[model samples]
Target: MRRHTLSTAVTLCFAASLAAAASAPSEARPASPPASQTARQQARVPVLVDCFFHPEVRPTDFVLACGDGNSRLTSLHWSRWGQASAKAVGVNIVNDCKPYCAAGRFHSYPVVVRLDRAQPWKKRPHLQHYSRMTLEYPAGRPDTFPPTVTYPLWN
Candidate 1:
């Protein structure tokens, strides 16, 4: 009888503590924002759109060849990413295509990447995206490529 009473008392105490905790307001809860602040927060910044139409900022890797897996940029370290332009240093991996594209070997070359000419994205007028890309090979480059090359980026 003593054990049964003691167990009942403990259970009742536990239930009361839980109820008190449930009624207490949380101190870590964030306060609601004003209407103007919410609108300002929703405003989009300039970005680089990938082949898949995804907006990216300071991406570590990006595809240069969207049609075939021939070329790409990897190990990117962006020094600047602003409304007008962005710059980075990375490796440009290209396929040699010695025998043929199917039997090609990939090679890596150090490159300096720059993106500029920001304009309103065609798909999303409210957002801006870079429209041009220039790559400069500091040390060595592919046999067919020059020291620098500029290409129009897809919107």
Candidate 2:
């Protein structure tokens, strides 16, 4: 009879503790924004960025290598052409850096490119070429580069 009473008391205590725990509230935390909401806030066009001229390939041509293989300027349509200066609307292939940077898919964004005035090449004066290049981005550009980017001849 004593053992049965002791066991009943212990069981009652355990049940009370469980009830107390169940009634208690959990810790509160701030909820983060939804994926679509975040995407909407950052919804802007990508830019034509990281442009340079590899002299070995050709001085007249410029390469837009923006880390990801897809973010590049493949073609340029010149509106004005001159020995000293030139202007063109560049057709660039930009990529959303999703999944991973190296394997991202491509998107198109048109940008204006200008080679304003020729300067003598530091090593080769015979090649009187434009050393200063500017890129005009419409909607967005790299945080590191300005809208009007003046790129060097051999960057």
Candidate 3:
């Protein structure tokens, strides 16, 4: 009986310590790429994000033209979910057509964004950190106006 009680207490303490260690804080800045980006980029390189809600499928194959900003870029290329590692996707998607749009199972946004400054956001202008573009499908079918994939990045 005494051995059983000691074993139980030890197990509980070990589990609690593991949980706390997992939650320790880490530095926010530095390169931050979504797992999918490299895989997809190898198959189909990122070209450009010309405009938001562009009427037609605007190809992003021109992103190289966008130039690397002063800060080193950390690309995030993921689908609606990041759990499954990014594999090359079907379709040569042009995000310019719908940069901020939610349409059939897929929603897209521009991570390389610029913020207007001199006020609320900052005293100076800034680029948004490596961000997300969502592509969701319900039961393997596209979700119209797919809800934004939720991720929290702290600075």
Best by TM-score: 1
Model 1 TM-score relative to the real fold? 0.72
Candidate 2 error regions (>4 Å) = 1-61, 66-71, 139-146
Better of 1 and 2 by lDDT: 1
Error of 3 at 82 (Å): 14
| 37-141: candidate 2 lDDT, tens digit per residue | 643432321112123221221223344542223445557777765655667877556545444433334466567877755655444443455666677888666
CA deviation > 4 Å runs, candidate 1 = 1-44
Candidate 2 lDDT: 0.50
Cα misplacement distance, residue 103 of candidate 1 (Å): 0.4
lDDT per residue (tens digit) for residues 1-155 in model 1: 57455545554554465455446565633454674664353244467888667667788998888655578899999998887789999999997765655455678999999999989889877778889999999999999999999999898
Q: How far is candidate 3 from the true structure (C-alpha RMSD, Å)?
A: 17.8
Worst 10 residues of 2 by lDDT: 45-54
Candidate 2 residue 138 C-alpha distance from true site, Å? 3.0
Best by lDDT: 1
Give the deviation of candidate 2 from the true structure as CA RMSD.
Answer: 26.7
The window of 10 residues in a row where model 3 has the poorest summed lDDT is 115-124
User: After aligning candidate 2 to the native by TM-score, how far in Å is the CA of 114 from where it should be?
Assistant: 0.6
Q: TM per model?
A: 0.72, 0.47, 0.18
Q: What would the TM-score be for candidate 3 when compared with the true structure?
A: 0.18
What shift in Å separates residue 80 of candidate 3 from its native position after superposition? 23
